[model samples]
Target: MSVDMYLGPSKTQGSTTTTVCDNYGNGLNSLQDAVGNFTADQVLRSLAYDSAKGYFKEAYVPLIQGAILVVEATAKAVAKLPSDYVSEVDSCDLKSSELEREIQRYETQIQGMQNQINQVKQLLPVSSERAQHLREANGLISDYTSAKAKLEKQLQKLLAFHAFSTMIFTEVTSLKSAVNQGLAQVSGGKGFNANKGTFSNANLNDRSWMDTIGKKWQDREKERLKDQMPNMDGLEYKQIDFNGGKVWCWVKKGRTTADPEDIEKSFLFNDWVARMLEKYGPDYFKTDREKGVTDLLVEQNLRLFEEVRTGIDSKTGKKLTPAERLARGASLVNSLAALGVGAKQITNVGKGKAGQTPKKPPIVGSGRKVPAIGKPKKTISAPGKKIQSVKGKPSKVKAPVKGTGKIYNANGNPDLRALRRPQFDEVLKNGFPDGTKLNQHAYNSLFKSGRKDIMIDDIIDALNSKPISAKPGSVEYINPKTNTSVFVNPTTKEIVGIWPASFKK
Candidate 1:
């Protein structure tokens, strides 16, 4: 065989291969695979078998030297990093006495970086020392690479500081050239920011550090825009201040119309948002109060936040304004009173569990003025149907009665309010899908010819009684007499707000 060529224990070497062995490469592969899959103890046992010539130890001699060299190289690189204040104090000409504040700031930053690198080191497992040579080599390489990359990104910042330091006390021309060279080494593209007084457009591969702040800002914007639009309605635009000196030109709800003023404002706001994204690069939201590409591409923050609304009736497909809600509330109130239910009990219902706490009803006399609720001049009581009051006081039958059925116990007594609960449950089971705003017409239609007030509180209490899969915001109930269904808002215990079973809008 020639000195440069090898002869192996095979008769034939075929195709692309120039050499072959009798055991072939398979023996080496199987041995290496064994090293990976064999129990650590098994490997230890095998390694423990003594060779009279100390053959296993001899085999690792070169590997041990290589490990020593690699560890030395990593240690030298780590040492090159300014992990100590002695280096910082020595590198800068800052006197020990000249306003110690600046020196402390630099020292603190150096210490922080060192601490971060140490934290990364501490993450290595305690068992790593058992694999000391290989583990040390890998751990040192990973930690050193991480620390170096982190520090490299800030080199320009450090250079600027150096330049500033020397600008007052020494020449900065060489310092600027050194910075350009450093930038060239650290990041290949873009350099020399005169405005920022540092390098620009370098090392931007991972810029997600700002996402946390951006998400936080987005949530704040969503909450503000949804909180009743702050005395404005329809489409409009407003410039709001973002934290940390950032600014937002937000499209919001205001007086929306196709008037010249409104058109011009809309056009200008759209133009401004477009120009900002084009000029400043990608952002998360297109406009504060509207949907856009920002919603499509991001996670963590909500994509869109719709304006706050009073909501629409599910049955009639009509918007429920505050006045309408109040009217419906009053009607439900009348029904509850006729069934001898109280407002306080209705408001305090559903406080049994942590998440099931009920919201208080919009109380009358709690600020908003409501018409005095005296005798309805009309009652759910049938005409000419005189009955004894709960206190056993005889009362005259009221004229112009409202409801359509006997809303009392089988004994013909209103005081057995528990008897009324079954009827309420019956209404809950049969009358509504959920959030159904029952009025005189709907209530009257619920019966054949008599009047019975379905107390709004009774409706709320009944609705809460039905079982629902998942934590539902509402439940459905049916009116068996009319075979009509309605939906009720569980949170408000109101007969409106949720979209009704019969209505799509």
Candidate 2:
């Protein structure tokens, strides 16, 4: 018999459910396929929409802004003799802020020019002399837009350099102090030890793993996998302090192949440290010099710092002159350009000649259509208590047309019958737009996997099967022949997850 283990109360903690599927892997595959189909453009638009709604500012900006101030203060306390450092950083910061105001003014002007062009096109004749008016208007907006873009590039450089200089000053002084104090020794406990490990040069170049780990540990939403999978006996839940934050973790019990100690160390070394560096640019810890520095988005440009500070290429052992390192480091704009959300390109300051122009990574998806995407509505339920649907205007769901063989209702909701594969894929890729919530575990398993082949359609298809009586506040939909099952949280009408029906059998 195949037994699947799920870790739950995921909603209150990580907001993610952990599922270990032991037998059939089809459920996961379907989700991977769906995620793979999302274009880079779609991802960018979704991010922009969320930002416009103040979601990112509310959730992230304060912690990061505060951290950066703290980091700079500590560096100043520990280091002495560089009279120019503080003055240079302050100059860059002031210039960047001014450039931002200039860019915003240009954006407003361009938008107004565009509106005028639209009006001219709509109300004017196509005569050559009149067309010149349109041309002048278009040309004006074009020139200003290009100018704004250049200012943006300049601003990015200032920020990147500011961050880079701070990192070097902080680390060099901290390392020296720790060595003198004999506090650079390796250690780990329930929390992380940041001073004792060596970071990969590769990590400095490609920190996408940082994003993966961030989603796994930080961006999770409330979800419980155990509600969907009952009578599972192979998993245990425990609490561990992850960098002073008490969070829940799941472990497979009696597993000889995987050591929990090794797993914890991996999290500390890779995930925890990555978060620290990305947030603070330097190590984040309380020191006699100052409280820990909290900042944001430094890991994005650490490649140049890593190479210059070490003075040799970790990969090829190529030595760079002090002048060469300074030149490359000074091209801060190239490094910072890759800092865009869902950036398609990266600035590679690798083995190339010092003065060689690095290729710029452009933000992808300009003028592409962004599909409407939103979060699923949430529902809450206490453990052991019956789950109930949210009280709202009842869903206006209707049945499919008789003998039409259609799987969707006229109102754009999924019906009880299985939808066509393409329709199913579209619905799942865009999220459960009919207000059905998807928990973090299910979302991450499908989209967060580096590569997979599952579609949301498969789970929705399984949901079309005959309903099974479940424990209070939950329902199970199963298709026996396909061995596909879906767990639904009745209280919120959320789809808890899709699991293999064979396990229940």
Give the Cα lDDT of each candidate: 0.30, 0.37
Q: Write candidate 2's Cα lDDT for 159-212 as tens digits.
A: 554455445344334333433222112112211223533221221233333333
Off by over 4 Å in 2: 1-94, 175-505
* Model 1: per-residue Cα lDDT over 325-417, one tens digit each: 332333333233223332222221110101110121101111111112122122112234422111211222121111222345567565323
- After superposing candidate 1, which stretches have Cα over 4 Å from the reference? 1-205, 212-216, 228-311, 318-323, 329-453, 457-505
lDDT of 1 at 217: 38
Candidate 1 total steric clashes: 31
TM-score of each: 0.15, 0.20
- Please report the candidate that would top TM-score against the real structure: 2
The TM-score obtained by model 2 is: 0.20
Question: How displaced is residue 450 in candidate 1, in Å?
Answer: 11
Q: Give the count of colliding residue pairs in each prediction.
A: 31, 17
lDDT of 2: 0.37
